[model samples]
Target: MKTPVVYVALQQFCEADAAPRQRLLEAGFEVRQNTLGRRLRREEVPTFLAQADAVIAGVEPYDAEVLAALSKLRCISRCGVGTDSIDVDAAQRRGIAVYTTPDEVTEPVAQLTVAMILALARNFPQHLAASRAGRWEKRTGVLLSEWTVGLIGFGRIGRAVARDLSPFGPRLLVTDPALSSGEAPDGVQRVELAALLAQADVVSLHASRPPHAGALLGRHELASMKPGSYLVNTARGHLVDDAALVEALQSGHLAGAAIDVFATEPYTGALSQMPQVLCTPHVATLTRASRAAMERRAAAHVVEWWTQASCLTPTS
Candidate 1:
């Protein structure tokens, strides 16, 4: 019998810690890590896994073709929560088990969302740019406590954000079909998405991204928002219509927006040119502690699935 091959498709996996690689090697499995030095593109996926039995994937796309081509591919151990990148249904059709560590990803992402929320509230980035450039400008900024903060999704990260914001005493509103009355936090009222959009002074997106699910915040949604209100997205890029968001900002219908992910990556799009929006290169889970925990757990998922044909239970 041949030692099964495990491919590490995530380019940055094991960079902070090598325990994941060690576990695979110790299991009598041959491990191959991505050497691309960057994000693994969809076209490059198949060749990279020419003979893989399992893979620890990042946010790489695994469409029908990618899954059908991999005859030996048995499982996908996702390093993070979101499966929007992987064609999970297609993988399932091919008998590929897809696993994720949603529980391990909550806190880090929540922290970044809070940080961006505060930044938008203050307008300090805009002020700092001017002060450094030899001009001093003073503008009145709103307090978090005074605004109606609406969360678009009530999952792990959204729940965590609602809890973290409690200290600031903002009026919390949430909208998610899955939200339960038993699980609703103190002062957090669950409302419909349209209601959340209409009433919120600061709207934050925490929704899951299902592939082909059209933009949650498109032109009509943006138009529905209270003029001059802020938008923050730590969620998937495709959740917002890029052109519509830009139009909202330009027309002053929205005060500003902050995003952590983009529809098109290595984002050189118009959103970057806007001073009102703060963007991060999908670094929500890039913390050292988060990386270590996710990597260890992600590797464990692959190992367990390889031997027992099941991965760890997902939180969300």
Candidate 2:
């Protein structure tokens, strides 16, 4: 029998941890990593994984055309949540199994969500910039306790954020169409999306990407939010209409926004130049501990599939 080949498609896979490579070698597999320091362009994907049996992937696109060209590729163990980047339906048709490390990202992302909300509320970025420039002024910031915190999605990260917000004693409102009203935990009121928009002083997006729907936070939705209310998106970036968000922030309709992901990554969009926005490089799951854990687990899943579980598609 030939030693199966494994491809590591994530750019930062081994930087935080080297154990994954050792594990693959111990399992009698040949491991190759993405050599390009950045994401591979669309044309560069197919040829890269042509001879591989499995791949530990990042947020790169796996469209139908890309999947069609892979002759030996069979599994993609995603290093993070949100399989939106991969064409799962297409992969399914081609017998290419997909997996993700959903649990590894939950805590780190939830922690950052809380951190962004507090930072925006207290003007942390602005104050730090001003102090650096030798200008000092007292700017009274809003308190989380004084605002109605509305969560759009009630899944793993959303519920985790709610639990983290409990000590602050803010009014909590939640709306997830997938969940019944009775499913809401105590102290969190389940409401309609529109009602939540009208009432929340701070709206944080935690919703998963809905299939075939345009951005959930488009013009109409942003218009419905309370004036001066803030937004924090550590979720999928395509959830918001960037053009709409930029206009809102510029016109002073929305007070500010803190975003970790973007519609297009390596994002050099207009939002990057705005003063009212705080941006991160799609790295809510980039903690050293979380990255190391996720990479190891993702690599393990790939080898596990090759050894004993290729017939069954493992849950991400």
What TM-score does candidate 1 reach? 0.93
Global lDDT of each model? 0.87, 0.88
Candidate 2's TM-score reads 0.94
lDDT for model 1 comes to 0.87
TM-score winner: 2
How close to the true structure is residue 49 of candidate 2, measured as C-alpha lDDT? 86
Candidate 1 at 151: error in angstroms?
Answer: 0.2
Each candidate structure's count of clashing pairs: 0, 0
Residue 85 lDDT (model 2): 80
* Alpha-carbon shift of residue 268 in model 2 (angstroms): 1.7
Clashing pairs in 2: none
**Weakest ten-residue segment in model 2 by summed lDDT:** 307-316
